[model samples]
Target: MQFVNSKAFAQGLDETDPLRSFRSQFFFPKVRPDAEYLYLCGNSLGLQPRSTRTMINEELDDWAKYGVEGHVEAKRPWIAYHENLTKMMAKIVGAKPHEVVCMNSLTVNLHLMMVSFYRPEGKRRQILIEAGAFPSDQYAVASQVRFHGFDPNTDILELAPREGEDTLRTEDILSYINEHGEKVALIMLGGVNYLSGQAYDMVAITKKGHEKGCTVGFDLAHAAGNITLELHDWNVDFAVWCTYKYLNSGPGGVAAAFVHERNLDKDLPRFEGWWGHNKERRFKMEAEFDPIPFSVEAWQLSTPPIFLLASLRASLKLFDQAGMKSIRAKSKTLTSYLEFLVEDTFGSRDWIITPRAPSERGAQLSFRIPKDGHGVLEALRNRGVICDFREPNIIRAAPAPLYNSYPPVPA
Candidate 1:
């Protein structure tokens, strides 16, 4: 597709965009009196959907009216509330409905998945991860390795890009696994590196890990709604993600986990609670933990948070309506336009750290602006172009397809 450096070209893209109407469905932030900002920070926190308040208020009204009875009497039935999101969530992550469950926060779900999948035996006791992964993932993997009486410095192997490259090559990763996979018990990596905005080839990585008898999982915080996933078809062992970023759930919204069906019936070690027990005899208060068979619900820790679930439901309805295929299609074009404009206007593409191939990235484009990058960030903010700057020297701009558009309008 030929791209032109003009406002009219952008307007043409917007006019032909099927997802254009979705922009009006969200509430954008204002930088000054009556001036709505061009919000490109969806990779940090999404814009609130117009329906979120009403969805949440309905639950509040239910509590006010039914009191304790709202557990079963509410419009969504709080007793089985989390179940309401299972099907839609599964579709987004490309897994079977029974394989996905919305429960604890992202880090908490990571810990749970590690507990079940990160078993270290003699000699094969090391964990493999990307060098500059999200700090939370690094911390979780380090803590888990230490909990099992191993030194994190030695047991956790970090994979880094070639000295001159800003992003990793798939061949390098596959070669690393082939050479050192025997000693690695668990391979955990971010589906999309938060800093470079490079999306990993999950299918190939998962296959390589399994060939070496290692378990593989992903932290999809940046990949969930930003890229197309097929966890089931790829045979990924386990994965976890938060809903707030591109999913358009509000800040601190609910997170989710996915366990492959092959692991569901296995007697894996998991920290269990009552909500995981058999639903038929749950109220009977049986002492034995009879986990729900053939379902990821066995990992549930406590009762569902109805308000948060309501908020998630509101955003997910839009996802269900748009479909991941359509969202991803728009995302590719929208992000490419952003790249074109950045390079065309700025006169150079050398600062971009994200992969040039659309298949190797998502909606975000991270720039390595070394000199006074924060000044650039502040300037952009003052101009009402809302983007985020990462530590050391990177600025991230993510044009979300759900509510973000291509035209040269007020964002």
Candidate 2:
């Protein structure tokens, strides 16, 4: 495919984009009235939709009007509130309604998932993960291994990229699994690498892990809203993600999890709380720890933050209206334009570390600067180009197709 000129390509893509109108629905941040900051940090925190204010207000009004009875009486009754958000989330992640649930923070949910899935026994005690998995995931995995009386240093295997490469090759990942498959208890990988923007092949990785009788899970922190996923079809054992990134839920919003149907009936002991208890018998205060099925709901710990759920509900409605397929189409073209601009302006002088192929990435383009990279990022920030800098050299730019437009890309 021939790449288009930066300015011309962005304009052309915007002209054809079906989801262009959705941009106005969000509240874009303007550090200066004359300039629109190119907010490309959606990989870390998505821009808030203007509609979120109204959604949040409605919940606040309900709280004022009903107080404790709001659980069952308020508009969008809190009693069945989380259930309302479930179907939409399930659709995005490709899972049954029962297979998905919105609840705790990402790390908290990761720990909960490990409780049920990481039951190490016999010789199957090692946990395999990507070398540069997000810090939260690293801590969760290490802690889980140590909790089970295993030495994390020895039992937790982190698969790094090849000697001189910046990204992990699929063959290297597969070979590692083949080498340690028998002794591995779980395979937890970032669906997309946070720094490299490489989208891993979940299907192949999950299949290989399951074949070795090891459970497979994913931290979709950077991948959830940025790309299309088929967690159910891929037969992934479990997965967890926060909605604040691409899902556009507010900061520190509740995260979600998915548990395959096959694990629904299995007696994998979870770190259960009352919310995960069977709904019908939950209020009865039963002593038995009966779970609500292996679907995402089984991981709930306590009451959900209704206000945050309200914001998510509104954002998800927008996602449903726009559809992931169309969003991804625009994402590919827009990011391609940004890549074109980077190469055109800096050429080989600056490194574009993220993969060039759209198939291998989402919307993010992580670029490495030749010298004084931090200063360049600071200069970009001062100039109203809002992107994030990872220590040492990389600057992650996510041209979010949902809220960001073509003009901000080059302005």
Candidate 3:
């Protein structure tokens, strides 16, 4: 599809977009009394779904009316409320129903998964991760290494890009794995890198990591609702993600985790809680920790917050209706159009630090802006272009497929 540099062309594409109507389901931020901002910050935080209020109110009303009985008597039943979201969440991350569970925040889930998967011993204690990973992941890995009585400087092997490249190459990653994978106990990386917006090849990475006898996992915070995933088929040992960004689950919504069925029944060390015990015997107040066998729910440490799950359920309803294939289809077109306009206007694609191929990225495009990046970001914000800035010299814009249109790109 050859893209023309004109507003009319963009409008024509918008008119033909199958997912165009989804844009109305979200409430956009206002820049003036009557006008809305061109919101392209979905990579940081998604626009709130219009139905979020109604969803939360349902739970609030139930609690007000049912009192303590709401645990078993509410419309969705607070006791099993997380179950209502299991199937939908499983679909988003490409896992079986029993493999996925919505329970805790992202970093918390990361620590939990690490407890079971990151078993370092002897000479194989190093954790291989990206140097430009999200700070939360960096801090989590460092603290985990320290907890295991290893020097983070020596035990955490940081994989960085080559001298002039902005994104990691698949061959370089494979080569790096071959070189140091034997000494690494866990291979953890972001499914879609936050800084560069590059989506890694999970299938290849998982296979290579396993070949070297290492545990593999991904922090899918940016990838879960943004790109195509197959955690089950890819044979990833474990994974975790937050639902706030591309999932449109409101602020600090309930996050989720996935454990392959192969690892579910293993006698791995984990922080156990009553919520993870056998549901049938849970109310009996038994003394033993009878974990729910062959289920990821065994990893749940406490009762889930239903209000947050309610908010995420509202967004997942839209995903169930739209389907991930359709979501990803529109995302590629939206992101490609954004890239084209940015390059056509800026004179070259050199301004873009994100990978050029659609398969290598998702809905976001990170640009290497001029020296005064913060000033440029403020200018864009003042002009109603609602994108965000990373530190130093990068400006990130995401044309979210769920609530964005082609017209905004060429506007």
After best superposition, candidate 3 residue 397: deviation in angstroms? 0.4
User: All candidates' lDDT scores?
Assistant: 0.93, 0.87, 0.93
- lDDT for 365 in candidate 2 is 92
Global local distance difference test of model 1: 0.93
How do the predictions measure up, each by TM-score? 0.99, 0.96, 0.98
State in Å the error of residue 405, model 2: 2.4
**What is the lDDT, from 0 to 100, of the residue 202 in candidate 1?**
95
lDDT by residue for model 1 (305-327), tens: 88888888988988898899999
Show where candidate 3 strays beyond 4 Å.
Answer: 409-411
Per-residue alpha-carbon lDDT of model 2 for 1-411, expressed as tens digits?
476655676677678778889988987777767656778999988989888989989989999999999988998888679999988998889889998999989999899899999988899999999988888999999999989998999999998988977888888888889888999999999999999899998988998888888899999998888899998999999999999999999899989999998888888777888888887787899988877754557678898889899989889999999988888888898898778766777675247778778888999998886688889988998887888988678889998889877754424
Winner on TM-score between 1 and 2 is 1
Worst 10 residues of 1 by lDDT: 402-411
In candidate 2 the C-alpha lDDT for residue 286 amounts to 91
Stretches of candidate 1 off by over 4 Å are none
